[model samples]
Target: MYYQVVKRLFCIAALTCSGMYAQAQHTAVKEPKDVPAEWSKAYAPFRMAGDLYYVGTADLAVYLITTKAGNILINTGLAGSLPMIKRNIEALGFKFKDTKILLTMQAHYDHMGAMAAIQKMTGAKFMVDEKEEDVVKSGGATDYAIGGGVSTYQPVKIDRLLHNGDTIHLGDMNLVMLHHPGHTQGSCSFLFDTRDSSRSYRVLLANMPTIVTEKHFHEVHEYPGIAKDYAYTLQSLSGLQFDVWAAAHASQFDLAEKHHPGDAYNPAVFKDRAGFDKELAELKAKYEQKMAEEE
Candidate 1:
């Protein structure tokens, strides 16, 4: 299962660059139509564990962490995905207007495109890693991944800036932020505890460390330490412990395989230590191979 998941995720990552480039090049106009059908398809939202719900699309991932005070929304997908995301949240018996905070794993266009609109509609305070604040505010214009070129999406104001080891508290929930760079200078992973009936689970929202650009690591002038950052991120992630883990991209966590439609909610499928270890190893191997090729 682990090997199969790794093969599937690696293939998805490998195709991302070509898919993105093709969309950028072949689109007649830069509109929502440019988004691939796979990414834009809507998926029914469902609860994953205590207070945590999957409110994202079939491809892009967005999560809603509920609390007595309000709710925290993570990763808004593309700018055109706002409606579908809202419907998903509402479908799950969640009030979209009650969302109090907005967070993201990274500041990429695809992940944070609808952030500004969501923040405006919910009047939520947008929070992000300090390292990602600039990129988020500029809507990927200041991203090291894009060579500092202006990218798509509307820019947003970051209401709060966070650092590594910082904890975000709301009601009875607490989430510790972990800085995992390389994918983006301010890429972050989050750790929190969620309960399922009698069992307590440590859940980690993993920020992927995949290299998305075609440029060689050393040649990335906008982010000179890309290679070093990835090395540090890989080391940092290995030390953390979690019972159940999920990633910013749904495919990374094998969402479809773990949770089928109308199936009884079982968090056990998410508890795969072997799968996690294998995934990290594969990602590290890919990074090393890229470095070797550049050398």
Candidate 2:
């Protein structure tokens, strides 16, 4: 009986130590040394649609959706992105502290690096797609594709777990969360409606599923379903209908060509259906080619 009791105690102790060790690793993490210049380069913020505004860098894209209750911030760019975001928000006459909810496009270190800091400062509830909860909480340390026990950002706590087709309610906004995994397990997109003085518009903040890992899905033993996930994301995003669309990166949607720094608040500037469709087709073609290579 004593031996059995000791065995059980040993198992409990092992579990406790494991959990503590994981927490320590997460706490000790910092971003990689090789920082991209464009990730932090300043960009002029502008209104994309009625309530949605651009508040990110020249390459990395972050968006703010204003509401009467508060505001919903989506996709805090790489680490150290808070100061820039703050400046952009202030430039647009919005308070950073007024952010009530935080969101993300993907769980990559670049996209989620500032989430923890922002959440701590604003006391905003951080919500993520159900599949991304673990990765976000772990600060990208637990990501299947790129995680190597060395984390890239401070871990964030999830206030709510979102699922596909979930409607996020914030004041007068009803942003629908679309789970478009494969970039990471829970990489997602947002779809919603907002209006200007002239007309209403449907806006899609699409999280494009650009493959970032090695060429072979079989190589990623951590995520056995990665191949299927990528296929699903590409197929799903292609059929989505929207009046205006933007992506996680400015170049992805051709921001410079569409809007200038001092341009007017014309939502029509983003109504490039042909551009979005062409990009989607090109991405789809690349995926098919990758699949062929895999075979």
Output the number of the TM-score-best candidate: 2
Which regions in candidate 1 have their CA more than 4 angstroms from the true location?
A: 1-36
Residue-by-residue lDDT tens digits, candidate 2, 154-198: 888889999999999989999999999888899999999998888
What lDDT would each prediction earn against the true structure? 0.84, 0.88
> Tens-digit lDDT track for model 1 on 54-156?
8888878999999989999999998889999999999988899999989999888778878888987999998899998767655676777662455566767
Q: Pick the lDDT winner.
A: 2
lDDT of 2 at 140: 83
Cα RMSD of all models vs. native, in order, equals: 14.9, 4.3
Q: Which residue window of length 10 is worst by lDDT in model 1?
A: 24-33
